[model samples]
Target: MQIVILNDAAAVAAYGANIFATQLQKKPTSVLGLATGSTPVALYQELIAKNKAGEISFSQATTFNLDEYLGLTGDHPQSYRHFMNEQLFSHIDINKDNTFVPPGDALNPITACKEYEDKIVAAGGVDVQLLGIGRNGHIGFNEPSSGLRSRTRVKTLTKATVDDNARFFAADEYQPQLSITMGIGTILEAKKVVLLATGENKADAVRAMIEGPLMAACPASALQLHQDAVIVIDKAAASKLADLEFYQHIEAENQKLQAHLATL
Candidate 1:
């Protein structure tokens, strides 16, 4: 796991955006694993601008989202599919047909989960998977105690998660208490993973993810076992990490090494 501490959320988004921009430039047909939520909003905006400027293009890209509310249809206002269309697909040149979000309205969720897994394998797997951590250190909807080697499936949302997401729904709106999400093992399969977090509210979770043990108790900590996982956060979000200075120093040295290699 690599930790990158930025000055603020905007910087974190810009840094994460650069990673995506570079990936798209290197492989225009890259299969990307995307995430939803406020954290990724800024990053998506950055990508939108880059696409507009012709710095990157999603014309040939295929995307898979992390999860979707179990009972919501694609056209539902609160569904992840709708969120993706509004935030990204509509703004880019990417073919909407190539984008995949777990089928929230599937009659047999069990079969649908298997099909979702199969689709990912057929797409050559994800080149880069983007993520956003919850305040409780959950990734996707795999709340606490999720199996470390689980796959795409339906999962019950924890009370904390439901409460956190309550704000998105109207007072009388029906909020889904379940979701279909990519499992920890499924996420670890991606060639590279980039997780972004910001704000002091995420500080403790960020610390547990980067500095905690590799246990299912903190699902985000599962990233510690991934071969290539990058954790990008603002200083505020990184406040609780024990080795903040060390992480910063390591990034600095890495930058210097890359610079030297560029000259060589």
Candidate 2:
């Protein structure tokens, strides 16, 4: 895992956006794995700006979201599909038909889960997966203790996760207690993975993921097994990491090496 600690959230977002922009530039037909929530909003906005400026295009890109609330329809304002459309897709040149999110209203959820997995494989797997870690170290709704080698499937939401998401719903609005999510095993299959986190609230989770032992207790720790996983975060989010300075030094050395190669 490459730990990239930036000065602030804005810088973190820009760095993350640049990664995607570069990927899209290199492979216009890239199969992207996307994520939702407040953390990734800025990055999505940056991509939209790039699209508008002709710096990048998603016209041929196909996307699959990490997860969705189990009880909501695609048309529902709270649904992940609607969230993607409102935040990224509607503003870009991508074909909506090519973007896939697990069906929340599937008549047979089990079969739907299998179909979701198959579609991903048929699309050539995710070239790069963008993710945002929850405060509890959960990724794609695979909460604490989630199987490290599980597949796409239905999952029960922990109380902490439900409470964390409660802010998104109105006081009397319905909040889903279940979700369909891509599992840790599925995520590790991606050729590259980029995860972003910000704020002091995520510090513990970030530390646990980057420094703790690889265990199912911290779902995000699964990224450690991936050959190309990048963890980007603001200083606040990386505050709890013990080898923080070493990580920064490593990134600096990597940048210098790339620059040197260009000169050669």
Candidate 3:
């Protein structure tokens, strides 16, 4: 596990984009595990701009989204599928068919979940996964108490989660009560993962994820066990972290070392 604290949100987003860009440069056809929400919108925008400038090309890249709200279809205005298209896919050169978001309205969700996991395997697993940590320390709708080794499956959203998401829907639209998310175990399978958090609102969760004990109550903490997992956040989000200065020094020294090694 590694920590990167930037001055603010825009810087965080750019750094996140650079992670993806570097991966794409090395493997243009890499499979990406993507996330949604306000936190990643800026990162997606940065990526889109890079594609427009020819700095990067995702034409051959494949993408798998983290989760989708149950009862909403791909075409639904607020569905994750629509969110991906509007936020990133539509603006990039990537083939629309290469992107995969879980079927939100699958009649037989049991089969759908299994097939979703199979698709990731068929793609040879994710090269990198982008993530956003909820204020409650949840990742991919895998709320508190969710099993760390679970797979892609249906999960009932906690009332706290639904209440937190209420602002995303119209007054009359019901907040999602359930969702299909790649479980903690499934997420850990990615070769690399970058988890982003920003603003003071996420400070507590950020601290818990990076420093707190590894328990199911804080699912994001599971990233500690991943071979390559990094936490990227802004100053405010990282405010609660106790080893703030040490994290900065370590990241800087590692970068210097990597630069030195590249010439060898």
* Candidate 3: tens digits of C-alpha lDDT, residues 51-161: 999999999899999999988989998899999999999999999999999899999988999999999999999999999998889998899999999999999988888
TM-score, each model?
Answer: 0.99, 0.99, 0.98
Candidate 2 wrongly placed segments (more than 4 Å): none
Candidate 1 — what's its lDDT?
0.96
Q: Please state the error at residue 1 of candidate 2 in Å.
A: 0.9
Clashing pairs in 1: none
Identify the runs in model 1 with alpha carbons over 4 angstroms from their true place.
none
- Model 3 off-target regions past 4 Å? none
Backbone clashes, each candidate: 0, 0, 0
